[model samples]
Target: MKKFFKLVGFASFIGILYYGFITYPKLDLISGFSAKSIASGHFIDHRSMEMIEKGDNDIKMIDLATNTIDENGQFATASVYGLKERKAIYREGLGATLIDADFDISAPYEVPKRTKLVSDKLFPYGNQEAKDTVFSSVDYAKLNAAVSNAFDSTDKKDKRTRSVIVIHKDRIIAEKYDTGFDKDSKILGWSMTKSITATIFGILEKQGKYDIYKPAPIVEWQKDKRKNITTNDLLHMNSGLEWEENYSTICDATKMLFQAENMGRVQLEKPSVFEPNTHWNYSSGTTNLLSYILRNQFKTHQEYLDFWYSALIDKIGMKSMVVETDMAGNFVGSSYSWATTRDWSKFGLLYLHKGNWNGEQLFDAGWAEYVAGPTKGSKGDYGAHFWLNAGGKFPDVPRDMFYCSGFQGQMVAIIPSMDLVIVRMGLKENPEFDFNGFLRGVIGSLKR
Candidate 1:
């Protein structure tokens, strides 16, 4: 009897250590990512349980979670071994928000009224069907073959491409969607949302309402070592704020996105590690800080909330977009945004045409030039909130090529030399899909 009790005490000690060091953080990540993905997949994307499970939640750790969908209450909760509990609630016009006791689910949420767009014209700019027009430079068979080849992956990466759209000269030349997804299906762009937030800053910069060169207006940083950090530094991912972006485990990013009540304020507490613009470290937290700065730009919270939709997103034609906010009701600018592939292409189009939508100039041309230039310390691989090929990341692709890239191979490659914007959104990434070859094939099919 004495031996058995001693053995039990030893096992209990091991269990406590294991739960504290490993299970706590891992379970938070699994529960958090699963809960958010399930709620958004169900409510915003309108995906079925089978599709949601097969696509987003089927990952190893996240798969261990048991989810409960409360359709009537409009929330989804995920529990991993009944240890870590996470919940995400869906809101009309606001998409899905991960919630805790501090977040008021019953509070009144208001969405900006969308201005009517003239969609009587054909697509590429309107909702009408695209007119069939033969282009002198386009190789019809090659373009068709290129798009078709993407749907059938030869490698083991399980390409799971949901949608692909190729636009040249502001006209969609090729488009495709996988099973259970169509032209109107809203897709999560993941970290591609960073580019969208940067575009909002561009609009403000164009209007002279904001300046990227100035120091980030965080009240907490005003008297500290972080006081010198500029918006340009954050835009270029060189804000020098300490951050860890590991998605496979709980880190600053997952904690900010899932555990914190106010995500934008999370980075405000990080101690400065390097001087601004001196070291390039990618951080989702930095973007949320920028979102925090954006909130202070307007007098009322309602105006700031309405401006993202009215000024940029809805103002253009991305009617399908929903940028989910945190529990504190601030846009999770670092992540969580949904839009149809074509609407994502329209965003590429907005940049392709230098912020001009058909005839309307949404922002100044200088903003385009600013986003294309390589950041000071990014080894020519990054620009202002956009990824660049200046370092030949895609060897054959143009050095001037820049893009909005997200996890799991979501890309919006814009090549000024080719006058093209190629949007490829999928579930699997490189080492299997041959990203460079795919781009070469598409570009080769249209090269003059």
Candidate 2:
């Protein structure tokens, strides 16, 4: 009788441990990431599960979840041990968003129609091929070797540098992709989406449609001390909002992204921990709040969505660009955006030329200056929505170089002094691939 009671008690303890601590948190985390990542990979990027699964499931513990695609329904489902299943549905213009049981389909949304390119001229202007040209100052042999070094996999993460594009003086000096991937393949920009969102605000400010120095226009903050937070503060990621960015557990970041309906409201509801501009902490919630502010700028829903494409995306020829949204129909501007490598290069070039595409100025040099300018309390390693080298984060890189960086080694590095823009996209981050060393090699291989 004593042995039976002990065995029963031990069994109950094991059940609670498995379901509560491990299974539940993982289900919450991987469900959203798996559903959304798989849906976008299959539907937007047009990748097979074999290709997507290799990268998506490579993460630690994330390998436990199983993903299924619903081609007819245009959605994907993810489950762990067949418990608490989560689904992400793909929408025509909005991209993929995770849906809860109460997810509303009746809500009306106005998405922008992409204008087809009719011209055949070369890129940065049209969809035609660029004529090959060789610059005398470039060391072709050394440059090729440098780009090749990114693929020399010494470890598992090292095997994942799927794409690399180097542009010097408005020309494609070198570009390469791993097997099963190509120039046309669309990869998720991850947090690189933040810089894109900030760039939109820069364009609006250039046209006198918005202001960054004023208090953030969130209505919820208007009645309290949080009202003092400005758009610039949000961009600089120093809003001091109480947030937990942990993803390994069911913290604020995972809960808001996977469980919450309105992503924007999650940050707005949090209490302020420090006065605006007094602290610097990176927050995905800050960028989503920035996206929310963008939504309220216009009177109608269509205008807000249209402006992102008409004014910036399509105008510059990023035809592959698509910014995904959350259940509340707000651009998941913090983390979800996908585009081809060549298209992403154009975004860096816009800033490289100080926002002038061909002959037309999209934003201005002032916006670039503001973006590259280091934010206070960031120790010179950060700027408004962009990461900076002013603190010499990349010692071999120039002080003026600022770049858009994302999770797992995704980068769009621009060095105006070097007339260089290097885009590197991969399934792994840091230590696995030495960013500083790669930059040193590429930069050293070229001379003006």
Candidate 3:
């Protein structure tokens, strides 16, 4: 009897080992794709290396082999436990696309017919060329010290600030970058892509292509309880979709990002866990689902891409911005966008100016207000996709300020009261940076 029990225990152990062997490849592929995408999108080698090392230390149950630059040196490929390799490549206009072991790489989106290429002309804020008159009311010494404090590291915390850009009254007053980074470096915005996605929805609404108050046009939901989910509910992150956003495990987020061919399909398959608009859960699945709806509105991928560029990025002078697509050609709108610090600041400026650029209204009237307005479901901490400062969440900062927040301490804060846009990008774990204090210091330094 004892021998029989021992045999059963040994068999269970073997099953566990086999399961680990099979699943480890998927985890490794996720890491490889993440590192390679950052490398190719940003055009940085050392940063990619640093990302891989950090990922290894962060996620358990995986072994990453050496990541190598492709023969052309424009892309990167990596393997897991010396098998099940994955590669990430950068397209010309689109950002990084990961090709994993099981992914069916789709044909590139066709270029649009109305491809009026905007010239990369030098603007006032381009290359940090600000007018002297713009700084006439500013305290240069105090502002410099405030910016310096953002980069300072202490024994208890690491700032790890890669770049900082301060725009006051539509002019770049101060700009700084780490040793290897510069104005042209394409830094990933992480979850801040959600704000860009929301902006796209606003544009579509202006063109009569979508309506936020109406029911979301998802075919699968037509016969189910999810059919009641409105576009506004999804934007407010009250979609009632059952999703696990955990990155530490092989959950919905990892599957949608690394394994799924169609991100939208994966999200749509989720069962409704609660009545729409009753509960508030921060789900990336809802954002990707929104991306799916946005894609289907246009006839083809070209029309979609063209609409985004002509309607938003080009008009705002965000020349370096790139929004990446998934394996199935759906924009990973929940998390993948890259742009320079200056370009990011320009995005903030657009919102600060109430969606008008140079006297032209790109977004509909009240669009910016709607985005910054607090969602009733989120307890006043969130808007459509933008994080709000309502309810005095940041006691030091103004109650009206709103911002695009992202993973790893990426922020593009907009203060309408101060006519200011502050951009800060960084990569840090266990961040000890005080955002409210930083904003207060910057505001206090102003000589207005």
Candidate 4:
């Protein structure tokens, strides 16, 4: 019996060694990459260091102190503060770099003016001047109660609501934040970045730069079976690419997010497992691929940066928004975008106004309708990139509602019928928060 136990222990040691040296390298890289990126973004955006440290508690395989360095000291070393799992470099000019494991490939990166641009213009709402008119029509008592409940964590262990903002008729009606967060805090919008990617595509389409119905301009698929796949298929997540979206393990999503220096190239190489536009599989790879295609539309990185700035961010006044790029310098549309709660609301407002901001059409005419319209592959639950409220998914909310949903309970729900936009951002692994019930409560509180 003692011999048997010793053998079992030896076997366990071998398994650990195999996983540590082989299977776990990607996972470790993902953790370090994410931690370094988050730390860099926070420091660059002037976020609280204490809050940033606390946020790292939920991530696996992360050593906050070792992985993160002071903002001034990050650029001096090849690795971001001497982190393991390859050299995750950080530079003041280029944010965090997800270096390849072999250290052979890294994209030419530049810090665009948009990254440092902050409009000095005052916000339309949330200031003392707008406060008087913003909540005048809202039921003060009921709206207050609803907003309070959204931020409350009385009996729920996983209900960490960071920020909640309710905009009614284009005015901020109610807003609340958790202890460590505020209106100015820029929160990460994981999968919600996909919707933003779709918007960028729509803007390009408006300018006649590309067409979704045509074959995607991916050189890899030019001679392959995937050559027939259209930009529309990628936007709808029906590109038929075989992608494992598992976040708990080191799957395609993690590989694209962390290990791959050229995320688009990694995803583009994926062979089709299903017929194009025939199946509805949520794929971060498709989004990243779309971002890559978008990048190709421009001759230089500066042109791409200028387009994003002048086209979307500047038009909607999303001044606090920051979209990060992979090592290949393509925006990681699948994940990695940060915006304040109000900035998220502005994004929702753009959708609520049918892709128009202040009477200027930011995208093609009827682009909003096309995006919110249900995809046949999704059975009315998902549109182009946004999640739809159709198919009885959110029975309490109007069927016309569409949302930008992200991992860990981030949402920017736009209810067009009600002229309402609700923004909720949080960091909960298993969310106990009820978005439907919360939206219902907020709608119920409206005086109209």
Candidate 5:
């Protein structure tokens, strides 16, 4: 009898140890995992990818509201809503699970289309061969040396930069990439997708598919006074919606990216933080809402995918552009888009030439100017979706340069005055680096 009791006690101890430490933490990593590495962008994890590789069984859940899993989860009462504090209860080591994971859905019934190309799409608009002929008057060797020296002076965090291409006067004079990542490896774009999403809106507007000037077409907006908010306000981040963009805690961005089924709907459900178009707080919620709008306007998510591929990506000669959508069938437009480093450079080139590609006017010329044009809030910077490389009222920078910047050091800087485009991507927090000083050095190395 003494031996039997001892054996039972030992077995119970081992069981408790396994459940408390190993299993609990592993489940935690799966359910509440958040890391921003080159591999998974922000909220996605390696385990999720592994599950997909092994036939995608890990992300299975049911939507109680719609009697479906694809819409949300089994206990969901709403389909699209913001990240409110949810009380969790772990069942058999499932880890911090939401109290309910279902939601109502009055999905928008519409279709997206590509309209006429804007005229400004032709800026920085010529081929390298044509440029060489036109600028036979300029020297390039000195220019390449300047760009190389500038990169050398700055600090590097990831060391994964496989290549750097410097385009001056519409020609590629200096180009270099790391050993493994040639022109083909599709690199991640992160928040750079915001700019791309904005561009798509431009296309949709020109086609008469959507109107930016009118109030937002959200169904909920019709139920409340929020209908007064215009699409223009949303694009400029003046939607006045209350959203916490914090990443460290399980804030709005975290919940939308990790917990919610549809990112756009989450923003729509949140109350107004301020009046629309009165102030700019820089919320990813705005972009997420745009993604939701886009999804609703298209017949299927795949149709929008095809539209972007044919209308923009393919025309720009971009071979690498992978956009990821959430389980709710909304594109993660504010984040989680990847393209090769060279492809990123190509986008810069496209912007530099306005919106024209190989003599084809892809964007309206006026719209291109509108994007690079000055805005009231950004102070000579941040036109439409692009960031103007200006010192603004404070004058932090010396020259006229603009860029499309993203989280953890993803940058695509375009200097119109110097006719240069610089692309950099890696995994690093906001380190101390003088972008203006770096530009000055590049100019110093190249100027005659």
Candidate 6:
């Protein structure tokens, strides 16, 4: 009996060693190589994208450029890259990836190095006054204390935070990044892309595009009752589309991220879950369909990027922005937008000021009000693509606070009553969010 037990133990030890030392090293090698491509400004292959969608490395791609691989294994200048999203964040390297990748890559065109701090102008919305507020600085010590307390109280071990920035009255009041990362890191925004997508649609409405009162511009709806679905319903997550947002490997959401070539199109093909505009089901499908509509409306990716950037991101001077691409090259509107911490703050401030920054009306005056209005799910408080602060009567924070939150922990909380914008970025899974606690603490710590 003793000899049998000894043999079993020996075998188990060997197995563990093999997986830890050999298997993990190989996995890291692949991840490392993918990281190299990002650093070198090379577009990562689909296989790499699959790895990221599975949350294998925590590192995800924000941009897919046109590139050709040759016999010598080098990327040339024929490829032109377009900025896609507003704030991009990386998953792995635990903040180590950005710096490491930066050191290795060589590009022909002057690629705007991803940094923690970025500034750019948005179209028709651009103004000198807005630029000033977008670049404002904050009190770091007090802000750090708040974030540190929030993190320490959490139980998750790998709770990595890449960046955090706070904005007040359109000025960046505080900005910070984890070790091994600076303002240039293009971290993935995950579902936060939904809010950004909503912004684009808002701009489209301003441009005389389809009105929210009318049926959505989806082609599939014209033949069926889905035609009753309105753009307003989609924006409020009330499209009644059938979709399971489960992140399981085979679930529709994960599959869209990992396996589907045209994520937006795939969602459009799915049937409805409930009556249009009646119920609120948090479906990525609505955002995906929005992408399809944008693609159908616009001529090309560059045109879409140009229109939005000139009108929105560029106006606010947000740099580190890069939107992800689907297999069809359309911006993945559901998930995947990347940017630095500071750049994200710019977005938060833009919305906080009711689409007006530095004396310029970037978005329709009603845009912020629409986003801050609640939806059917929240008993009429969560409106459009943003989340409002409910269950009021909290300290330091006002009852009317709202925010644009993304997967992991990318957040842009806007406290309208307090004239404050709080941005937090990190990795935190659902059914276990520590953000509310953090928000409470931050409000508690604010200088009274």
Which candidate number has the best lDDT?
A: 2
lDDT of 2 by residue, 1-448 (tens): 9999999999999999876776675676686678778898999988887667788567775676788998999999888778778889999888989999998766776677787555787875788878886998899888888888887455445548889999988889989987778989998998999999999998999899898999988888889899999998999989988988876667887787788788888888999999888989888888888888999998987788888888888888999999998888888889988999998999999999999988888887899999999888999989999999999988889999999998888999999999999999997777677889888888888985
What lDDT score belongs to each candidate, Candidate 1 first? 0.85, 0.87, 0.76, 0.75, 0.57, 0.60
For each candidate, give its TM-score against the true structure: 0.93, 0.94, 0.86, 0.87, 0.68, 0.70
lDDT agreement of model 5 with the native: 0.57
lDDT comparing candidate 2 with the true structure: 0.87
CA deviation > 4 Å runs, candidate 6: 1-144, 150-158, 379-381, 391-397, 429-433
Q: Quote model 2's TM-score.
A: 0.94
Candidates in descending TM-score order: 2, 1, 4, 3, 6, 5
Write the number of the candidate with greater lDDT, choosing between 4 and 5: 4
Clashing pairs in 3: none
Q: Model 3, poorest ten-residue lDDT window? A: 55-64
Q: Compose the digit string of candidate 1's lDDT tens values, residues 1-448.
A: 9999999999999999987787666887788788899999999988876688888886877788888889999989998889888899888877888887566677877655555556787776777888877788999789888787777555333667878999988788888988778998998888899998898899998888998898888888888889899899989999888999998777899888878898988888898999888889989998898888898999977888888988888878788889888877788888888999988998988888889887888889888889999998888999988999999888978898999988888989999889999999888777566788888889999857
Best by TM-score: 2
Which prediction has more favorable TM-score, 2 or 4?
2
Q: Write the per-residue lDDT of candidate 3 for residues 28-147, one digit (tens) a residue.
A: 555555445544544532355555444322334433444666546456666655565667766666656776666544543654223333544334324345545546678888888888
Stretches of candidate 2 off by over 4 Å are 1-20, 106-108, 152-159
All candidates: CA RMSD in angstroms? 3.2, 2.6, 4.7, 3.8, 10.7, 9.6
Model 5 regions lying over 4 Å from their true place: 1-162, 379-381, 392-399, 429-431, 445-448
Cα lDDT tens digits, model 6, 1-448, are 9999999999999999975564332332233333433422323222233333333244433123322233243322112232111111232211112122223333221112232323354321332323433222333565668776544234444556656766665555556676545666666676778888888877776677747778887777799888888888888988887878864224567556544657787768878778976788777767877877777776765566455556666666665566655545566677767676766777888887777767877678787888888888766446787777664423335668877778777788888766788887776643355666667666654554
Ranking by lDDT: 2, 1, 3, 4, 6, 5
TM-score of candidate 5 versus the correct structure, residues matched by position: 0.68
lDDT of 2 at 173: 93
